[model samples]
Target: MSQLNKNNLLPLESPKVLWAVAISFLCIWFYMLGARTLVPTDEGRYAEMAREMLATGDWITLRLNGIKYFEKPPLQNWMNALTFAAFGLGDWQARLWTGLCGLIGVFSVAYTGRRLFGARTGTIAAIVLGSSFYWAGMGHVNSLDMGLSGMLAITMCGLLLGQDESASPAARRNAMLICWAGMALATMSKGLIGFVLPGAVLVIYTLVTRDWRLWARLYFGRGLILFFAITAPWFILIALRNPEHPHFFFIHEHFQRFTSDVHHRSGVWYYFFPFLILGIVPWIGLLVQGMWTGVKEQQKGFKPLLMLLIWAVFFFFFFSISHSKLPGYILPIFPALALMIAVYLESAKPNALKLAAGLLGLLGVVGLFSVNKIAHMGKDAIDIPLYANAAPWIAAASAIALAGALVAWFFAGREKVGKDIAILSLAFGGFLAGQVAFLGHNPFGQYIAGTAHVAAINAELTSPTTPIYAVGRYEQALPFYLQRTVTLVEFPDEMEFGLQQQPELWIPTRAGFVKKWLAHQANHEHAVAIVRTDIFEEFQKQHVPMRVIGQDPRRVIIATPVPSQ
Candidate 1:
């Protein structure tokens, strides 16, 4: 009965209850992995790269739409390509790598939390991470950041577990090696920052905590060998195959992208703060409490909480000062934040927990009322309908959150039931709510994906040999849907580097595209082109003979007449 007096996170104490919750949460988590359309830029781009890899059977030289693409490393692409090999190409297969990474972060943090702190803290940490809005949401999306973050979590957790004095000598060596390997995999996932950022954090940790002895535990000799073993092969192979790759990938992509606004992704210093807040979702109220707990924590031995604090703060400032900033860039700090928050949640006062629950409920209510505003969020008239279509999902997500928060609030102070139920309700609620909102986004995602026109475009094709061209524009998602590469005309966009390497892959001018289209017509060969609406209109005014097979607000699919029979 005394156990009932504990906080709202009761299920953590019971093995049966914890397993039951884990199974249910995982089912929903995996189900949503394949539930949505692959959106542009990230989702479609990565998925198509993997598709091309699988199609072409070239593993080392990564290509996008049949052009050399070297914007990042190949770990995620390799995993995604492997996933496609096993499961076949689809939304879920593309996202499986990221989804697994998210799970890896959750479980690793949980295990680390259990090892460094206690069982309760570890269990709560997993709950906090698995449900956090950014982590949970990004996990389901096919993106590189989650993959990096997940591996980074393993590195951080391994460091924490390996450094603890209680660990046996063999355990310590093994954990440290895991830490090194994690960093290497993370580097392969994104870039050098995987190991660089962790190294910087370790340096700072050593200086701040003055734990000079901690350096000896790094196992650098074995670790460096392991790191290179994981990350070096592809770098060596790709550079050997494409000489231009070394300069562009190493210097231009990493250095120029960080120090200058070359990518046009510059953001103000505080840009990530808002994302961090919203990303934590229902846990927003406890962020301060968690940080405060970390700041005030002081121990004689290895300071795990302090290490976490430094990890989070260093990353926040590092990216804040970078010339390029995206919301996902700050993801590496979340695992540390989860561990800090779990420590706070373990011994939090009932009244404080109640207050946080109340605030979460209020947030849900606010979201419910503001959901209608989604209709106005669209920048274009066509997108307005899609945004409106997603409003109901927002409302449903909000209601679920509100319901969970209320239950949590009620159970916060209940001695008979304990706080376990309360925490579980809110965490599950946040996870489900985020998933619902993501599901709601499919209507707009589909519009952006141009999948609605894939069938129409396919029907116009006389055979698989029908030539397709993208004129004055690129539809990132369409290539994956069509399962074939299109000839690019008068546009390079992100594929400029790839185009530069192989100039024959695309037409450089509209005049050239027009000439090619005419030649195809003269040869009586059926060919399709996805033209920007304005370009299509311009071609129409120029008396270009083509049949409109399919069109959306953004683009028009024009096809040449079939061969004379």
Candidate 2:
């Protein structure tokens, strides 16, 4: 613990240097938020939701593509809608909420680490979390996971900071309020799991440590008030407006999705382990030693480190056992892991840091050499060109990481520079490398965004209100790009619940779509339909009236054929 007292070894000792690095990283961070195109099904789905919310001015009942959507809560949509309202709709604006949430997670963890441990641990924890692949990568994306994770990070940190025996009574009360409020917003961000996961962790922590005194400090009466104040109104309003939201959202979205493979997202028990390792990235070498140290260092009274362990390990197992699984499901655990890693790095042997840096450098070299293989990752011809276009940016990212790793290795060996510069160099490298790779992915993402077909669809539009049908398929990003909702024809994927609520919002049968198309054709009305290539072929075989407006190998955009002269 005395090693943490040596401020010289910390990266934050030099205020000017730290400020320069912080400002530069933030610039790149915010810049990249708008730089990348939104990809499906998360990015486009969320963005379009916000766009519709802004358009319709309906904050209570959530809608995706003008149909009722209640798979998750509306906190993120509210933030995103607010972003669109303030900034007008754009790529950066769509992602602003997520970007801010990721930043908030990083800074909050840093502050918690500083308060619980020292300034050194605080700065290092920020570096580890901010540079980690999953956290950093998803921060730029507009997704519900990052928003939920950010609020959870606050809850975890607030609980730890408030429960610390050294905290004054007044400080404890304030921090606990923040913790409760975080849980409320977190619940609004995702679902019940926000508070439920943390509640379970706290219970497990108490039972194992026998810290019976810890429960007294929770301020439950006040906390619950704060929680409901932030969370209850929206739930009440939505339930009141929709009447059916409670059953589908609470029962179907939460319980059914977790207990069964209702969403069809089930994975094996070890689903999150690989992602956890990859999420650790350049810090992987420090993980074991960090967790071991966290376990070993136990103090009288409160056990913050033990609580962190329970938080991470419990959530890992909880999600792994669930029938529903996703790469982002485990995101909330990263902040706790970041704090543990920071403590280990602060007093770690120079050789260990060097080895970690060297391994990252090796990964960079391998990435640089193997980047050409990215072109082959495409499943079809349309994707091959996009992958090829992204290869150069990925190569550049690898080079940047390699250079930073080498610099970190050199500084790790120097007693004077110590771990401060080495940690900063490695973190900066990893963060920048990720941003570059993300920026490079825009070409591929544009196709997924369905932006390429937007112009042709617009060109075929004889009227601004011309009907655009999604036949047996839904291009998630297309409606967002076109800034208008498309009528669903015979396919309801994630929108099944939403469509069930408003059956008139979609056409449920091919015969119904044919009938509608012939009606439009008879009226000499121009209409556009976006369909999969196979579906297009089927429609062609049926002699449906259509003319190709635009197409890729994956999707064909067709318009009503001109009436016979």
Candidate 3:
């Protein structure tokens, strides 16, 4: 009987619930702020591709590495290109659209939750998940994750709202239209996977639940026209213009990239489970607990719970089975997870809530403690970096610890406070993760930008024709950061096929082509010398006309072709 009060979610005027949501939103907004530059993980490529679009004024073809890039569609790049047009090719501008899309996603999640559950669940879920590390981190990034997440949420909302039995015909039609448009935008954001995956899930859910009639009423006649109307022109334009792109992008780049090791992103199955946990850290316990409770409550017929379970399970396995893997691939499921958890917290038993608080607190404490140990880790001695905001992260550590204790106390009185604490704690977890990883010195700091040595090399050896070769392999970031052509030395086949150009001078990999280069040195009459692939190699140690540079630990640099001085 006491659980009855717990079941009745907090009233709209509840100060605790309001504060929890407000705090969560503020934290998420702050966490994602000022992180609008192209980082190594595809940001540089995306930004650069947009830059190329702006430079050539060719909206029809999307090229990366100087070759026709047919992998994904062009809406994101077009949005990014527009940003570039408005603000030049600046990193901040190029990435602004991504952040904006993230904001849209956050808003969609909140709106969807509110409609499906209640104000308390909607606002809290929005706030908590708004501050989520995965969302925050990917939000500001110039990648497809944030945009896809935004479109996915909008589509899910439309689908869910369309399912409302009492909705007016106009409302249902609006939702169906949004669903189609969202699918179109989502496909534009990534590739076919965006529509295929979501479509598969929705179809399966409707089939299992015996709601297939929803499709007929989706107004596909009009919705399909609108979808193609919005999403088609670009595909028609790009495909017609690039000629060989549609097949290459659809089949080889998008499909084969998933089914093959071509991108070298293969991983053991279940890898994303850990990433999913970490991705929504601080919220992991709450999310899992909510999911577990939702599953248990299936007998009671919680439609939202079942929907999210299916949503998460489908995306999890679909990408997990694919040969390609990336951290952002699973972002679409988080909003569903967030709403599900929020709904459960709003509706779970007090004892269950008590268990949730303990789990969330315990998990947060462990995370804070682990970060404490990592804080003292030395930099330069290794790849680890503790930057300017290290102090802030450390400062938040105690607060995080306090949040755990607060969780325990919240449940001691009004059990409604359990959901409030649960939601707020998840936000704090997201804030902490974003602060630790991106703001300052962390292992990620190194990957975020090219080495200053590269900049110094740029300053020294930079001429209109200095010929910057990326010693052996390739990092697409080189072109965007350096604003020059970076030739890959060994992957000549890829360079020819992708980049469609060659370098003036070849900086051979010392280890890979030692004998071949040595024989070349012997056969050549010109004054020739070989350099090692390290920062401190003989000719590369002291800064000359050029110097070696690196983006990460594994990649190295060695300069060559002193330009016939």
Candidate 4:
């Protein structure tokens, strides 16, 4: 119950109180996690992939829409498949792996901060990380990035713990082993960057700090053995089973993905700068101040702060130079930044907390006013009315966050840092609640996810084996919802390689599809195809025999008429 002084430094809360608070926050985090729906392109795609893996009983080789998918390693998919097995497939189950990894990342940061700094800093670090917009949002979503980020955090923390001179040789060895294992799991989660980023950061840190003695204590011999042991079996098994796995996964997925615009995800060099600034929302100013303070503060043997700075900067530039860019790519750097900010926040003045709170409140007001703009931004993809309908939920969430920030500001003015941190935590919870509300509204998913239409198709099917086709485009969510793979007709977007491997399973063009459809109808076989709305009309003009089964604004599902007896 001790209040913070004017300088805003406060003693650590008792262990019992801290644990209770952590447990309570975690419960709230999990409760709000299930409120959102699984979205397309990533969430639905990954979930369906895991579901397919579970259904096919083939663990070694991964597949998406019944095609070999080698774009990512199988660690996350393995975890998700297991989750689906333990619990029934649903929104929360699909997201469980990412969410769990994020929670682990939070605790790992807390433990590492406590060991390196103090209990107070550790506690603050957890709060900062668990509450950040990027960390919180990505944690609840199904994505490879969060799992990779979380594993890398553990790797970095393990390295820090192991390299401490004060720790016993035995403890350091064990910690280094943990570091190796962390890297192995991280690699399994997201391929090369897991190893590349951590290795690069360590090398740079050692060269700059001139810590030549540090490598001796790293226990490299045993560590490398552990790393290879944990990471090699899957890669070897996958390669042996599928001859093309190594070339595609290691070369095309990693090398080509980075150096060329093969994925067509090109962005300007400063693309991530805005995302990074906005991602840590309401904490940007504090982050800048915290980083500056970290640079100035000197530590004796090894400089954890400098190493963290190197980690953040290196990741930023490393991905910035890549042809492909995404907001989640920079997620791994957040925990380091959170720890840096926690260190500064522990000793910051009350006025600093007040200023941050005020800024957060201002952001809330802006969010309230920007609903229409946000709704219109997605007009090309979704019905604007859907976004308008979802706006109130977002507004309510923003209001709650705004209120919490104001209360935190009041507490800060009273020199009560603990109360201020507590309020800010609630504010972040509100932000996440808003995100869930918006996602749950299913505005975007309604257009992209073929679940409802697939359901309609399923209801009308006379047999489970009825042939289905996707013409000219692939709906990422359709296979998952239908619980069956559809034959491709003239579309090979990301599935080009897979289609090449199984040419017998696809129709090469609209003409080929028409021929196949007539053959199926002549044989009295029921066949259905989902096509773009425009393509459906074109087919209708061509006088192709079709009966519309289901239609959405973006797509239409039609079936071959049953031949009269």
Candidate 5:
């Protein structure tokens, strides 16, 4: 009912309200995180790596499916391993690091916005960051990108806070130190991009804004020492222990992976465009306006808004030029964009708010109408019936989002801007949580993780050390669910380097795998091998002595046939 002034602009102004919101976010994050089974390639691989580290007591060297995996740094794995140690292994524990990082990133953006702009801006920024589709989705999964993006947000926030000339000397010093520590942790989370992207942003910002004096405030000598202290030990230890760790991690993972397309993940220049558009979702209209506003808002001394615009732009273009690209690569830019939009929303006219809400409502309506098509689109890999079962939940969530947007639009039209923003934020957050809890996990569990088949295999295996082979394919979730490493039989897709390091652990060809299967049959050992259904049929036609033990549409687990009595 009250018109928002500078003092009363923030919707949840009381400390109690803030704490309540923070706790609510935490509950949603952890709940959604635990509700989902780990997806393959990223979630399963990372979780398996952490599991291996905890089991083997090897914190430095990371492994996937018992093979040396140096594609990324070990910070995320280390955090996950520590979580597993504290909480015991499960989906929640595996995702704890990313979830925590997401929470921290939200707070960091809020704090940064409050300090630079106003309290209202800060609260809005937190809501936007927390409710964003990509940010929230990635946070619930075990991915390195969320952690890296979170740390980078801290790095950017710290730098922005420290750059303020009016800040006390001690506060500035502490902020710079935070910046350095954030950079270190970020580097540990992913690799060089932690330092590279932020460093590039600072350079470009300085060059464009002509703020050379900001360099003096960086506390370079002490900062560099602190950074090395936090980041160097793991690299040094891993290199000393594994002779090939440094080259593969530093050169192959970082340099070669960036400069060349050795990973075969090449994409066109605009590969990230769709992700950027859809990632922000309901806020897309506001984000575009915010970007324009951010660019136009130049002020005397330090320009925080302009700096954020440059940060987002530099991050976008940096990844755009890279030889390889993934949707998660642009995550770090979302917080910056959120802050900009928050600032815009703070002083925005009610009409503008209404327009944005109406558009969001329309988008939700469109999604609801297209739910069937969206669910059926993945039928090639997923069971259509099982996947389509999530359509109702998705439609319900979309309807809730639409209802909230319409209500917010009403509030905005009635000049209740703060209520409008609050309602809109709550709606989006609910939609995100509902989608994650109801829709995101089950399809992935059915298709990617093969949870039923893995559970069946685990049930069938009498011994923890039962020999299981992955023939012609590697299911990333198998080792994690079974709580044991699978022997690779003619399957070295991404584990070629690890296979090279320990050649004896893998059968090099399909023929070699058949020979091993015959040997197990001759010895009367109860051995199982998971292979594609087509491959299993082919092997069966070859008169391989195996019986189906467990199966899914995509894969089958076959064991050595019991001898005729």
Candidate 6:
């Protein structure tokens, strides 16, 4: 044992269990502060549905834009709707429940790490999991990612702990029975992919390791009974109430989404290389070093270490081979990797860590640079101050983490390099905060407020219940902002859906509106706002008339029908 090992931080062999609990609480508190901080992303859509459910008093069907939106399960909406009912339609209120779910992931990893490895391994594992962009990014948002991730981590942790003793009746219950329950929650969170990938990984792992004996731990009779008790009730209730849901959800949504490119989320073969490289963040160096060291020393005997390397690699290739891809698809494997990295670091020689920390610190700087450049492109594209809002905090955090690197360099010979890096985890935390500060969600009621602005300008012409039709297409964000339903026009068959609907608003390309009007639709629709911008001049060149009632870089509101009393 090293000098630091002799002066153990905790009397227990592992401190990670306690550290994990502490970190989970801290992360929750941090996120809880600005539940209303940024606007929701995909979160807004879910939140709005919750709002609609409350508005219309229909909870089971889950509607968006007043249309049936059953693509995603209603777990998030249920949570958000309950929050909104309790606390009002506030952003944080809706997000708070889901954020708590994310904290479950942190707790799962920390506790599981300690249970599977030891205190040092547990702490590093929790930190690695916490530092991951996957969960943390999901943490502050109102999305299914965190909930799905939480259930996954819990189930995996149970499975890991189950490896300890198949014969123990209690362990069997917690590990197999309870683990299956967590799998059910994951399925509820995002359909069946929740249980599917992890189940697949476990089967493959058991096969390769020749560990069918682990199956004995499952206690098939008790396990099956408990699994149905926990998971089946909800499926039965939902499927019976919404009968068509079974065919659409089971066959079309899950199977088709994975096996085909139907969703069109397809990316190149190596889509995740960049995402993973950035997703690990400030600790990319340590993670890389940890993975490398873990792989090289696998013959030295780290079961979780060996298992995770195989797990992450298998899922990576598995999803890459699949027809559909999204950045969040790889989330399940991260907790295992984090734990593995933690274990590898805990087992590393004292002198080796300094070089590792320095390399990681440098890698963080490189990641920041890449993200900054891409953000600039986003800034140009969105014409908003997105990158501008994000750069300073990111740059500063990188600089500080690098300084911590220097500190680690000087203290490399010390036995507590793992401890030092944990302390430095907050520097990475700062980058996340900075990123949030910049890209902070517009909080509901913020964006497309051009919608509200336009409504105000045309309020005399319309009302709280006005019949306004949107020609061509519309942004759903705008309608939510305006609190109105819009009518969409079809192809050249305008006389049917178009003239009959006769929308007051025409949010279409200048070319489409011009073609429709010129075809004897009406001379009245001649004066258009975007027409000047798209037809006569680029959006940047056009100066809108009628009124400069409200302005954002994305929109310019103007009065349409002069005014009515």
Model 4 stretches astray by more than 4 angstroms: 1-20, 372-382, 416-441, 562-565
Give lDDT tens digits, candidate 3, residues 1-565.
4443556644333666567656765565544544433566577778888888887888877777556666678878899889878877666676688778777777777787777777767776776566666876777677888888888888877777766656688887887788788888998888787678878887777776775566667786897798889888988887677677677778877878987998788989987987787676545546777677547554422255576778888888898999989888898888888777777666666555455446556655665566556566646634434432364565465356447446544643454544455445545544654555465443244344554445655654545655444444456565776666554455543434444322433434444343433343354312212122452343244433332333345554544323442
Tens digits of per-residue lDDT for model 2, 1-565: 3354466444466777779978998998889888877899899999999999999989999998899988899999999999888889888999999999999999998999999999878988998999998999989888999999999999999999889899899999899988999999899999999899999999999899898998999999999999998999989998889899999988998999989999899998888989998787778778888777658876888988888888999999999999999899999999999999998887888887887788789879988988889867877778778888888888998998899899989888766465677888888888888888888888878877778888899887777799999998888888888888999998897899888868999999988998999999999999999988898999889998889988887689988889889
Tell how far residue 496 is off in model 3, in angstroms: 6.3
Q: Output the lDDT of residue 231, model 2.
A: 90
* Candidate 4 C-alpha lDDT tens digits along 1-565: 4443543454346555566766777886786567666777898779989999999999888888888888899999999999999997888888899999999889888998898889878887888888777888889889899999999999988998898778888988888888888999999999988788899998999898898888887788998899899889999999898998899899999999999999999999999998887677657658788788657867888788888888888998999999999889999999989888888887788777766777777877887797768666545434666677677766776676687677767677554445545445544644555464556376556566766686678865679889889988788777776777888888877878877776777778989999999998888888888998888999989999988888878799998886776
Candidate 2: deviation at residue 452, Å?
Answer: 0.6
Range of the 10 consecutive residues with the lowest summed lDDT in candidate 1: 1-10
Q: What's the TM-score of each model vs. the native?
A: 0.96, 0.97, 0.81, 0.93, 0.95, 0.77
**Between the candidate structures 2 and 4, which one is better when assessed by TM-score?**
2
Clashing pairs in 2: none
Of the two candidates 2 and 6, the one with more favorable TM-score, higher being better, is 2
Model 5: residue 498 alpha-carbon error in angstroms: 1.7
The sequence of per-residue lDDT tens digits that candidate 6 reaches over residues 349-465 is 645566556655775576567656734744444344555544554565556556656665665555464445443443344334434433433322254323335455345333454
Question: Model 3: how far is 278 from its true place, Å?
Answer: 1.9
Judge candidate 6 against the unseen true structure and give its global Cα lDDT, from 0 to 1: 0.59
Identify the runs in model 2 with alpha carbons over 4 angstroms from their true place. Answer: 1-11, 376-380, 563-565
Ranking by lDDT: 1, 2, 5, 4, 3, 6
* C-alpha lDDT (0 to 100) for residue 130 of candidate 4: 84
> lDDT for each of the candidates?
0.90, 0.88, 0.64, 0.81, 0.82, 0.59
Q: Candidate 2 vs candidate 3: which has greater lDDT?
A: 2
**Cα deviation in Å at residue 48, candidate 5?**
0.6
RMSD of each: 2.1, 2.6, 5.8, 2.8, 2.3, 6.3
